[model samples]
Target: MTKDLFGRHRAVLPDWLALYYEDPLEITHGEGRHVWDAAGNKYLDFFGGILTTMTAHALPEVTKAVSEQAGRIIHSSTLYLNRPMVELAERVAHVSGIPDARVFFTTSGTEANDTALLLATAHRRSNTILAMRNSYHGRSFSAVGITGNRGWSPTSLTPLQTLYVHGGVRTRGPYAHLDDRAFIDACVADLEDLLGHTRAPAALIAEPVQGVGGFTSPPDGLYAAFREVLHERGILWIADEVQTGWGRTGEHFWGWQAHGRSGPPDIVTFAKGIGNGMSIGGVIARAEIMNCLDANSISTFGGTQVTMAAGLANLSYLLEHDLQGNARRVGGLLIERLRGVAAQVPHVREVRGRGLMIGVELTRPGTDEAAPEAASTVLEEARAGGLLIGKGGGHSTSVLRIAPPMSLTVAEAEEGAAILDRALRSI
Candidate 1:
């Protein structure tokens, strides 16, 4: 492929655009778990387009559905109802076990999250929101405000008094000194104290499995406890399953199920794998909460025909094949293999997460310190060896996030792990 002429000193690119620090590669094509760069170099996609693409690239069924829908009707204004829209919403509600829930679709995760927040605030007539430290909602202003990552922006804080909950600590790497149980207790205490001292919050949002926050799965019964506390105060629980939803975590159709929680969330936002690769997102909220807001309050493009078709196709494929079962089996094998690799590689501090949503945290020699440099080196070497992964977390950038498609086979899992093991050895 020709060198991009757009990489010049004089360009009309927007000044606000901040490219990812890594050198960009021009990907020309993709298939299941693999993509070819413009130069024809193939890379195994363990990252799965940042943990989206649940079924894989150019899936025949999904493509056929999109094609047929495109041919029939691509766009329908909100003034009229569409079949795909109604069908997808019904399917999602059925699968999620929230029969009375209603869906408000959007084109991306951020928009979905933003809509949820708006609805929550409007319904409760409350100004404050609660979120977990290291949780990632989205990039939009309201969503980013609740995101606890300090890396977002120096001034990016919640407009309301956002309460940051502490679930656990690294105990090694970036959070070496922080204790997990103690931190959780402190957080719970803080929440109780705040509730007793002040007015109730509009909502308390959390990722069932914190994605950008090191893929940390909180202690058992933690989410249930959170739900209990929030419900007591008449506050809504919003599960931001942007990364953990759509059967990626295995053991269940949703990550909240993996938490062993009993009650359902008042509001659940989904994106990423919902449309497989096509852009679509939505909020599934309790009928009561949904009814509090006027229909005219939200604008157009919330439920376009093309996105609804893709979402329907994606959900149908997942259900028909029982891909969640695949995620459980393959994810179990992946964790076992990764743990074995961790035993051999001293730099590997911990292997955490459920099912396909996994993170390998790295540490430095002699000290229980995060080796960001080593993590970067391993990522670079892995890319050189034709494997693709991502780095995330608070301080370390030491978490190697592995979230492949739900359809990734056992053989593919083994091969990907072996290649990653080789890359770790080099580090």
Candidate 2:
């Protein structure tokens, strides 16, 4: 049955849509932090559907909220007052740390970022945009324009003029050998140089951590320094927090807080995780920028009743249980455990990340060349050992991405780590 379904999926889906493993397992159901394949074999979930499942699977609060909302009313569009949407927006704005923040809901991170780009270009009257190298924003035409990773970005034609910046990854860039302060200074200098050669860009968009580029991050305070320069030139900073939002990073509620010295960005885009499993995404911006458009617009399905209800319930559960704190504690231990395991593996290049968003980059022993085959081996072996993980990286897809639900328990972490340890040793 699984083989038949896999064949059918390949027949219907785009070829570019990649799947993991040599033989993909069809996930039949999930509960807590575990999922079962069609063959009735269960595996501990580490990727959480690419970090979309923030809380545990089948969380009662979220299920109840979805069921209740669906029974009441599912779709009304944005024509009328949406109580749940308003409530969720208020909560998100309060937590977003942006002053006079206005929220606009969308169906996905791509749409959220598209809306942000629209706002930024309209407000600043420029089409040029600055983005960090090794960043993945989304897959839409507008979002893809700003994406800096070559593998994920397939098109050269783009509506916006995008200029790639330096310093998204600290491990293998031109300034890799420099100290943290020196690296930040070098990136800032590069940004200054780029600005000198082109028209002032509408905004500078960046991820606090480059997710699909292998959970890599710049030196702390790097963006803060760049913000100082952008602020003087009236350039908006857009923080793409699709994968790093909702306290996944542990120390900060939002990933951009790692560079908090410069205060909040002018605009922020978020999706994944916040809705639990619901399709919810949105952009938060200052009122002036959000209101820049003269004509009216509305997303026919954005801020629908059902998704908002799920979002409200899921968010309430996240805050009430303090899952962020749990991510910090459990994720810290998990990283330490993986680091210890990686220490014994010659092919493991580096173990990096914060909270549950950890990455183990694979490389040829004693060389900088990426070992993507080694990553695939570890992924398959770990799955065979009753663990499900993910692989990602711009440089040949050689990074093992491990981001479990924020509600992950210490025992589960230990179990997953042990399985991963064996998988790494096998590789």
Candidate 3:
């Protein structure tokens, strides 16, 4: 019955309510690439609030925009047009390179994903959806149903019309090396086999870079091939960019663009970093697909005036500062450093992912929870050394996930890497 530092009522909460019980460090404030606890202890933030603070926390531009909008107008029903909403939608479409894209706003990534799911089912007149195994869409009923992780499965998921595709198959042992071509072929084959028995799905949804799935990148030509197959089957290809969008992947404003494909997806969803820590999520859909959706099926708080203002400010920052370029440069250094660290540590099994979204897989050295323990130890030790990191993947809390803000500097990257190195050595 330990009480929180604030003297709030605290008890042994259930796992569902453990998020509140966990004594998260009280971050009093943040700036640039660092956050401070209530005690004024500065910590280098590598996790970047799970990659939501793209432009950095307390960004002056974003803060001003939000403040101004709040002072003037905060909420405007989706029925009425807001200037910021319209401008933000235009910017998202322009950056996505998707012509005639219709935007539908939501309060969070889960809501946006839920809307996308509904649109898919309604447009194609099919209930089935194809999603990548190990993928994490969200926590809502529909979003969770489509999520590939079994740990997120609810008691009644059997009734949902969802199918899973093994994006990356393990051919070696636990630390298997993946052959890109073979993996893509297997995925296509799996989909084909499923289609033979079940009805053609409404859409095939996937994260461009599998975020929670160990930050794994798909095989080359895989996205193009997947789109072709879906088109042939008269199904939509919905790229769930909730985690990979907004310059986090570098090389492109959106991760789908990094696929090096000319044809855009039928629908692309975005959330993290869209408002630079403010609550906002949106879906950009091709005109044809959008036209099919009922206009009345929008969210009440979808395009709040404040959220729109934050989105616009965030987008402006990204475009003006060329944060995407910085992401590429800094991300290259990060990958190199991670690879070097892996080479030095035998327990470090693999280093995977693209750009700033990185994952370090640990092997079972001697402990029963070797991989997970190593990851936890690294995170704890990093925190003690003035850095905050996150965890994800197989064990529901194992893989060391590092997805920093796009605005992070090279020096910060070096410092975070050094902290990681020290943590590994200590562990």
Among these predictions, the greatest lDDT belongs to 2
- lDDT, candidate 2, at 349: 93
Ranking by lDDT: 2, 1, 3
lDDT of 3: 0.79
lDDT over C-alpha atoms for residue 153 of model 1 = 37
Residue by residue across 1-427, what tens digits does model 3's lDDT show? 2235434523444445333113557777888889998878899988877789888889999999999999998996878878888888888888877778888889899888888888888899888999877778887888888887666655446335888776532422232354766667776776788878888899989888877766766665677777777778898888889888877877676777755463888889989788888889988898887778666555689888899999999888888998889988999899899889878876776787777888887777633243776777787888889988888775455578898888888999999999999887776
Against the unseen true structure, what C-alpha lDDT does each candidate score? 0.80, 0.95, 0.79
Off by over 4 Å in 2: none
lDDT of 1 by residue, 249-275 (tens): 887677777544657788899898988
User: Which one wins on TM-score?
Assistant: 2
How far out, in Å, is residue 286 in model 2?
Answer: 0.5
Q: Which stretches of candidate 3 lie over 4 Å from their true place?
A: 1-14, 18-23, 156-159, 168-178, 260-262, 366-370
In Å, residue 149's CA in model 1 sits off its true spot by 0.6
Each candidate: RMSD to true structure?
A: 2.6, 0.7, 2.7
